[model samples]
Target: MVKYLIRRILVSIPTLIAISIVIFTILALAPGDPMGEFALNSGITAEVRENIRRSLGLDQPTHIRYIKWVTAFISGDMGYSFTSRLEVSSLIFQRLPVTLWIVGFAYLLGALLAVPLGVISALKRNSAFDMVLTTLVFFGFSLPTFFTSLLLIIIFSVQLKWLPFIYNDTLQLTDFNSFIELIKQSIMPIFVLGLWQTAVLMRFVRSEILENIHKDYVRTAYAKGLPNYIVIIRHVLRNALIPVVTLLALDIPSIFTGALVTEKVFRIPGIGALLIDSINSRDTPVVMSITFIYGILIVIFNLIADILYGLLDPRVSSTK
Candidate 1:
């Protein structure tokens, strides 16, 4: 397992480089000049403008600029935001806590709820509860999160007036009242993200459990006078969870990405909202930084999933 992990880590280096190259190429080609204002200013001399462009590395070739970017990133300097005039890393750090609090918690809540719900639904099969849950699961993921956000806002914020529609970023959690306010404001957005992810996870878990439950091993365990619960827990869950782990690995990094639409609707200051603003302002530094972070997360989580395959099922050879 350790050898396999080391090998995977070695493989990830080139994979990340390839991903960075693609991201850098796309961002470099994207329409937007950071120094467009200087070019448009009649009073600015052409020499001064060229000098500024040179300073910003805009005068360099795309490949040269990419090399510089990677070097700076490795040196722990994420460059400055074109609009904010602040370091890109600093800006992202400022917003990281907010995204983690909301989106991270939502993902955790969804994953936890999905396991039991899926198990019960599969166990019950075609019972009324199973049928209802299946129907709900179908609609849960079928409806977009943004739509759910709107519906939730209308019901809870407008009609019922039970919760705040807009998130309060400035409200420091210095007191119990402030904490309660945060919870009230966070409910809708969290629910929207959580519901969607829960539906997706539950459906997959239910299918996996149902398939594994009828296998020869499960029948043999039952024939040996093992309890139904023991057979399902010991025999069924281990194999069933392998694929679920893969699914979870794919979904977990999304907490860092944040829910773009839900955050926007709730007026939350998060990485997703920052990404949106950067794109609109044509702030390539921030945009590239966020996308690169996402690429890194994908590679990391995929590696984790592979490592877990060996742990979850001994049949899955790690060295292979």
Candidate 2:
């Protein structure tokens, strides 16, 4: 296990390097100037903007800039944002907690909602209850996140006035009331995210469970006088869940990806929202930093999924 893990980590280093290089090169070649905003200023002359751009090292050859960026990255100094002139890491860290809280909890709620509902729907396949769940799941999956977010805002925020239409980033959690206020603002975004996750995952869960339930081992467990529920839960579900675990591992990292639109809709001040803003402003340093970080995260999660496969199925580790 240790050897396998070390091998995976060693392999990931070069993989991450390749990802960073590709991402940096693409962004470097993209047709957008970090000084675009300055160009819009009627007061700043073209020559003044050129000097500003040169001062920021944007005038350097792409290879040189890439080399400097990579070196700074290795030294734990993610270069400053082209717009804010603030350290990229600081900006990410400031928004990281918010993204983790909202995105993480949303995924958790989704899994909690999906697993049981999927099992039940499969158990009662073709029933009215299953039909209703399927219908709802269809809408959940088919609807774009922004549409659902707006619908929620209208129903809860505008009509009922039960929740805030926009998230309050400035509010500090110094008291219980503040915490309650936070939950109130968070409910809609979480629901929007959770609903979509549940829709996608529930189908996979139901399909996996259905495939496993009638297998030979489950029948043998039943023949051995095991309770039906015990046979399904212990023998069937155990095998059914292995692939689901991989799906879950991959999906966990993707919660951030899905949260990009949700965060913007809710004005949550999350890392996703920051990344979008940075991209719109063509803050190449910040864009490069965030996108590279996302690449790293995907690699890490893939590694984690591989490790979990070995843990859940000992045969995998034995083979290694």
How do all models score by TM-score?
A: 0.96, 0.92
Model 1 Cα lDDT, one tens digit per residue, 248-311: 9988778998889989999999999999999988888999999999999999999999888988
Each model's Cα RMSD: 1.5, 2.1
Q: Candidate 2 lDDT, tens digit per residue, 163-197?
A: 99898999999999999999999999999999999
Clashes of each: 0, 0
Candidate 1 residue 231 C-alpha distance from true site, Å: 1.4
Q: Cα lDDT for residue 221, model 1?
A: 94
Give lDDT per model, in order.
Answer: 0.91, 0.88
Find the candidate with the highest TM-score and give its number.
Answer: 1
Candidate 1: worst-modelled 10 consecutive residues by lDDT: 311-320
> Pairing residues by index, what is the TM-score of model 1?
0.96
Q: Which residue pairs collide, candidate 2? A: none
